[model samples]
Target: MSLATTKTSKIDRLAELTAKKETSSGASLWREAFRRLRGSKMAIIGAIVIAAFVVVAIVGPWLAPYAPTAQTWRGEVFANQGRFVGARGENLFGLDHLGRDMFSRMLVGARQTLLVGVVSMLIGLVLGALVGVVSGAAATLGGRAGQRLDDVVMRVTDIMLALPSLLLAVSVAAVLGQSLTTVMIAVGVVQIPIFARLLRGSMLAQGGKDYVLAARSLGIRKRRIVLTQIMPNSLSPVIVQATLSLATAIIEAAALSYLGLGNPDPAVPEWGVMLSQAQRFFDNAPMMSMYPAVAIIVTALGFTLLGEAMREALDPKLRG
Candidate 1:
């Protein structure tokens, strides 16, 4: 056989192997990742932390001993004289500057905190993934026209990425006006560029592989190829990123709240709003700030750990 025939045979063989790997019951990446995750200490710890936080966010408020906003113990604490009450029999987390129950406020605020992170991450994921699918599919399948479309999309994302993430979110919040929805949108917008870029790059990488080349050579429809083959394989990094972005979303939401661009209602008990309130008495009563701050840090850490574990588990290099 000619050298060209030999090369073609090798490519065909490689494609057959890839197709078999993709179709095999035991070749599932998600299932393999789950098995790896189960064995990972980091994943276990992170899961525990996340589960505890979620349970608290869901149930802790219902069992709160005192009203989060009530100042029934106001007379006991004196902010003017810098005399704050420490944790005691009556109040577990001690009194804030306003003499409100810290424990109760934290419990009630957990829901809002979780809500902000989840909503923001979802907004980013949905919008960014849509953008990525268009850009990636075009660049890989649309030929010259596709490349141009991808270019236009990427250039816009690049501009957004060029700006500092926090600055962009702050600008968005500033434009939208202060509210919880505004915060979620602002934070979510900041994540769009990251996801778009990641997914587009991932799909492009997949486009060059033997399976894709074989599919193209076999006269498959571009849309079917993209939707069925390329899209599924390219989603690994994006999935991991979504997990990591949750942690970032929570922190960014809090930052917005700390900047006074959160829910306008002072009566609402949110972790970010709570932190903003605690900053005033940080010097006088550090515990007021400490509790919420620690909570935020721990929650972020838990997500980060889980994300890292997932990345490791999903790594193709470790499949052996």
Candidate 2:
């Protein structure tokens, strides 16, 4: 009846509406992601392409007619020795110098590439989130000590950003000496600055919000405030950064592998390694270069599309 009571009722009504809307079938995050994804034709196509690659990567061994590492004399052959030019009958993508099945190898290569990319990006996400949260929330709240640490972290980030990512991966991989694990670490390290900077911005924006201040005023532990209050609000941008970083990380891994700085064994199937091998046979076997190249491009484009769609979906201004 009174003005204050009416205002309280309205606030409660708004909260109920918001909760209902958020819980609706198409209004949840994943559903919203799918909805926004469908709105972009290119993103949808990219998703399909990426999904196909994943399926192929998973089932390729079964589908491949011959062993990827099998070596036969008589120079080389492909795809059960069919009329597909590089088919070679037994070699789907044709044979390398050692008569290995290019198609079979490529199938295995996709799995390795995806593994490196996803793993490296995951490492970056964890490290970057910690660093960014500490740099932003701590520096703002910790006073001079936090500020000093923040400055150091920012300088490191700047130095990292100034370095070419490929060059960094090459340098690190060169020192670590070419193993799949090392390749993942190298790519992940290169990606940390990207995540850190984005996260710091998100944290700083959320740090001074009313809820955060209220939590602080309630004598909540700094960790709780940072984790619960500031962190939640900062997550949107972090998610966006993560999606984009997956693409960058994949490229870095591929470059490292291509340079002979990944996968200690020459026999290991990796798209980059396949490309490296194909270079020598360019004149005789152009398709050798084409398939892997197209695969990498399509995969990268898919991540980019997905990232763009995520950004748009998460953007409040764009969503309405």
Candidate 3:
């Protein structure tokens, strides 16, 4: 055979092999992560629990037997000079100080709590991601000017970190006035530093990887490289943080509400508001406090477990 023909045949064979290899390895990172998540028993259980909570939040008002704030003392036997009352059959969880059905209040409260949690977390996630991306990109791509910007952002983050999260939230809530919006803003503000720092660190690490270096050498635009390449690669940690911070945000919202810093109206059926009201009846009726507290705990646990499982699934080091 002629030398030119032999060379052409070899090149064609190599191209065929490369195509087969590329096709075989076509699964994206997200697809693999999802596959890993499906195999995680903890992730599945946590997902189930979270789904249940979401369903309850959506349909709870309709399922409730009575208006959350409606006063009804239909079937209660007074004891201890009318200080304590027997559980009414109509109100499975009994009644509060004003005779509102505890079960109804709890059901409605789920919607309020989840709304605050989800909304606040979204605010935090968006603001934090913006700050983190700017800071990370500046530090990675900017020269001395970028360094100064990064320093300023990190210093501000450090200041926020120095303050206790709940205290910061309470202060913000107090300043904003007592309302659901105030509670959401307070919790979201407190969470900003956490997400900012996490994403910044992830982006910084990703910036130093081989792919990023190659992109830079190939004359890709800095913005394109950062947004399309680095940002996507660094988002696993942020996603995990978002899941975990959701639990924290819920607890913080409740705490702010408990402190009389959330939802000024006493008639609103919020978990935190319910707890605050239940405090006066702690001695006479403990069930009022028990119900809301359990809801908070279970909801937080579900998010936390799910976040941990996501971390394990996304992180190759943790994968067995």
Candidate 1 C-alpha lDDT tens digits along 1-320:
65434533442332222222232346687887788899999999988988988999999889799999998877767534656688999899988877799999999999999999999999998898889889999999899999999999988987787677789999999999999999999999988877777777778778888999999999999999999999888877787888889999999999999999999996788888989988887877888888988999999899999988988777665665
Q: Highest lDDT, which number?
A: 1
- Which 10-residue span in candidate 1 carries the lowest summed lDDT? 14-23
Q: How many backbone clashes does candidate 3 have?
A: 0
**How well is each residue in 34-62 modelled by candidate 2, as lDDT tens digits?**
67768888677767877987888788778
- Each candidate structure's TM-score, on Cα atoms with residue i matched to residue i, is 0.89, 0.84, 0.87
Off by over 4 Å in 3: 1-27, 74-88
Query: What overall lDDT goes with each candidate model?
Result: 0.84, 0.73, 0.80
Q: After superposition, how far is residue 214 of candidate 3 from its true place, in Å?
A: 2.5
| Model 3 lDDT tens row, 28-142 | 5566668888988888888988999999999999999999887666334332343545466777887777767888888898999999999999999999889989998999887
TM-score of candidate 1 versus the correct structure, residues matched by position: 0.89
The top-ranked prediction according to TM-score is 1
Q: Which structure is stronger by TM-score: 1 or 3?
A: 1
For model 2, the superposed segments whose C-alpha errors exceed 4 Å read 1-34, 73-85, 88-90
Better of 1 and 2 by TM-score: 1
- Residue pairs clashing in model 3 are none
Model 2 per-residue lDDT at 69:
72
Which regions of candidate 1 are displaced past 4 Å?
Answer: 1-26, 78-82, 217-219
Q: Give lDDT for model 3.
A: 0.80
